[model samples]
Target: MFVIDVIPFARFAPAGALSYRFNEYVLPGTIVSVPLRKKTVPGIVVACTSVRDAKESIKTAPFVLRSGAVTTTGILPKSYRIALTKTATYHLLPMGVILREMIPEAFLTHGFPKKLFAGTGHSLSFCEKTYTLRIEEYKKIISCTKGTVLIVVPTAVEIDRFADTFPSAIVVTGALTQKKRLASLKKIKDADIIITTPKYSFIPIPHLAHIIIERESANSYLTVARSPIDTRIAINALAHERSMQTTIGDYPLRMEIRPKPGSALKSISASPIKIFDVRKKITQAPFKALPEQILSIIKSTHEQHGRSAIFAVRRGYASTVICRDCGTSVRTTDGRPLSLITVAGKRVFRSSNGDTVIDAKALCDKCGSWNLIPIGVGVERIAEAVRNNFPNAPLVLFDTNTIRTPRDARSASTKFDIPGTIIVGTEALIPWLNPSNPISLAVVASADSLLALPFWRTRERLARLAFSLTERAEKVAVVTRRPDDAIFTTLENRLDNAFFKEEDSMRKQLNYPPYGHIVTIRIESSITKIEKDTALVQSMLKPKTGIEIPDRYATQNKVVRTIVYKYIDIQKWSDEAQELSQKIYRLPPNITVRIDPESLW
Candidate 1:
């Protein structure tokens, strides 16, 4: 018999390793089925000791050890194990939790296959430019590579696009049926090139040589539902550990991952862009959804038999409702502004968080004023205005409300493909358009609203969004209230490198990403317990120089507090962070930690 230490993959598993007795000697990193309470769960064997060697410890054990059976005799590669450990430590999460997230549930429930390891070579490069150019580069790389290659995209839409481009490549996405997914797994072993989303990036492939990450700046790569884990970081760490060639490509690459010094690529777009100062027009007509210039361009595109698109920052009829008499803006219970949406031809108010819903006909809460006005622009309002002006033109509304499924997105894209058709939508519409065929005209109806978002990377995000639009359209118009903004000036003048320099300078001054690292810790509990929990966390932190603990705030139902840790030097802070992680792991389930959080809010 052997004494085995395993990391169990259970929803509520404990913080550290659990011990069990096994009949056969299970090697470290082997998958095994261990008895966890009344149910059996899959776990990874981390250590093994012979019964004779652990005799003294076993005799003085506090509890009897459960028996476990080996599910797969194959051991995980040393590089993979090291990568997993590093990821868990960096994210301040349990090894079991990180393992459960990385490996597919299907592979865990069933045993891992024997054919997993592959050859590798190490090289890292960046393709910071338009998606069209990125695609061309990818094709060249795929053609030259000798072994199996893996391309990981950020979304399912990209998976479909890549599959269309590479018909012979195997495709894996969460939308796949169980049987289809299983089939793809089997085909991956023989596939020379495989395209998939980040969820299945860990699936084993024979002779895997190169891993490519597309649209590396996308927010979808960071998950926030449980603990935040940046998939890009994990993938890069794994590639580095295994010494495999890796490439990360994005339009106007994010600051943290931008190429070093002189190797950085210029961020110029092929298409021309024009910026319109909309403040004068708004002052003339407060509710004008489209400027005269944009309207003229749309009409000219229709007359010339060309496609056009309008990008709105919001999704509803109005982003907020304000009382005209009292100057009060309607808000949700959590203090978030409410949007007015037209549902079933009835006006309704809803928060972006989806926590509060109310009828729009109600009087203002601050003052019993019945005179309320909708403020700000949204996709629905822009679509309505376009439809009213160009009733004969084929128009498609492409927001979250209209396109709920992949089928809907495909249908909308097909309709927009027709010449003389006008499509109006939010950011969701950007990925659907084919990059090869440039639209005749594209208009950003509300650029200022996007800049108003409460995130530190708003400027960077806006720049990426604008560049993406420019890449897909021959003539692009961005209407902004703040025409003098640095981003606008940079876009209008085609000064890509200048924008990068300015952004880099600002980030360095503020100690943001590429200069410093931030870790956010959140605690959620009842109002009564929140104060006590927050105080305990503060005590543990002990007035550190970089630690910031703000007052507790209320969400929809629970009280929440956040702690932030900012540090510039990894060597100086790593040991302290690791020690803090162990203490945090012992905390109650209500506390969660996020390393390099995407959004402060």
Candidate 2:
């Protein structure tokens, strides 16, 4: 019998590139008709090779033969293989698994949609900026070219603008209904240009000449929460396989960046930025009262002056409803701040016990208090405050959910026609404004919170957000408590760009992403002790396995324990890790090991 080589589809192991064989003539990159045990099934062909002579001599085959009937689909382009292999290795995934994401989802089922565009492209450029996109170059491409164009963006907001700019284009995302989705897919298959998110674009299309453009080169956040596959590598692979052209720009280079304390978004009529040190803004703000000053700013912007927006990063009335008496915060057993969940979002927590879902009304584990308050202010809460302060103000609010829709944001950039239209929001809330209206006034409250975190990407993220909003807004004011910290100074001056560069270098030196490879594994058990699990990991991964098992179980709580292993025998370790994970998974109904994590935080 001719042996078949089956390849798992992308969804089978998201963020993982390991291609598992079903033990059957799996054409390269094609779905195969095969048998699993006594049942007929489907599998993908990743690679074809003769059985090794050593193995052949040791074990006699059960009449498995190398026959000419098996077809060759040609080697998946060298660049395509490099991308798949690099993504698999660097992302700490199995080589065979990562290959899955490269294959379009449509090909895994029915025949290929070759009439439509498909394939990956080499990056022409990369931008870490928000809502990244090309400048004059993109306009040039569309004007001269006349083939089916597939342009992928991280958010629908970008797609909306693209649709408007190019009226003939069609947009597709998760928000579309089945009918709309099918229509959009059909449009993708038929139209000259298709603008869609990555997952939705995984149609059965083949032989595509795609132009891969990323305003923000796809990031980990690109993973659809349900499927959790990084579309960056996958889409790039497809683009390469089909000889598609690609252009990447995280954000515009000429865009504003708060490089210095004196610099900030100076209005479209002025410079890219007009930095306002909160220290001085604090002088403008009444020092005697905090919230009152905030309220007054709102009042002035609405009743006393022109339109402006206020941003509060934390959501809910208060982040923590604490006990003033005990001076203690209500917290989880692991010492995380307890939050007050909203009525709708709170009830939805019941759906996922796997991830910690705390109800806002749930009493504080410390000082049982309905006196609970929300610690951080979210976009919704900020919007509510603005609305309450200026009851008669004609304003439109935009958040992650609403900004996601291009139609809903049609008039988002228009100034308060009724005089005092104001928008209050979170970081994401501010970015939805019309790019042309680059002179809007805004206030960013609690922007300092993220600056204080120890995470490697914190500063870059903050800078990106600030840079994006400041460049778009006319006069932007950031009110932060840390007016003297490195982050503050970075925002206060352009010298901070150096810090970002240094940080980038540090990440490179440490072998962290864009520098090295990162794959994290998390194990959980309800009945097992943290110490015992750590001991087992130490014993199993013997010394000089060349794998770095960083100081056992970094953190542990009542529900779970975490251990991080950096740069080791990742492929073999993954297999062994699976066994250990299985062992803990079998502990009891309550114990579970969340395997092959795409994210650590």
Using TM-score as the measure, the top candidate is 1
The sequence of per-residue lDDT tens digits that candidate 2 reaches over residues 1-601 is: 2234455343333342122323343445554544333343344565554444235632574434433333333334344555555444434444454555445444344444434333344334443333323444566665665566667766766667777877887776666765676666665555666777665544444334546555542242355333245666566555665566665555323221113212232222222333444444535532221255556656766665566766665544344446544667765554555544344534311111223556645665676665544445555556556566667777666654355555666556554344566775566554456555553466666666566554556666665566666546666666666565454555555434544555556655665544334444344543356556556655644552223232322224343444554443434643554444433423333222222343443
Cα displacement (angstroms), candidate 1, residue 296, comes to 1.5
For each candidate, the alpha-carbon lDDT, in order, equals 0.79, 0.50
Per-prediction TM-score to the true structure, in the order listed = 0.88, 0.67
lDDT of 2: 0.50
Off by over 4 Å in 1: 1-28, 34-73, 108-121, 260-269, 281-284, 543-557, 570-576
Q: 1-601 in candidate 1: lDDT tens per residue?
A: 9898888877777756889888878767787777777777777887899999999999999988776444543567777778877777778787766776777655565455555554456789999778888988999889998888899998887788899888999997778987888888878777989998887787777678899999998777876457867878778778877678999898767878886521334655578779988666325444678978788888998999999999988898988899988998987666667899988988799877766788988778778887889988998899888988899999999998888988998878888788799999998888877787889998888888888876787777777788787778988889998987778877776644556677788877777777777877788888788878877776666666335455444575677677777767755555766777777777788987877775654
Top lDDT hit = 1
What's the lDDT of the predicted structure labeled candidate 1? Answer: 0.79
Candidate 2: 10-residue stretch with minimal lDDT: 254-263
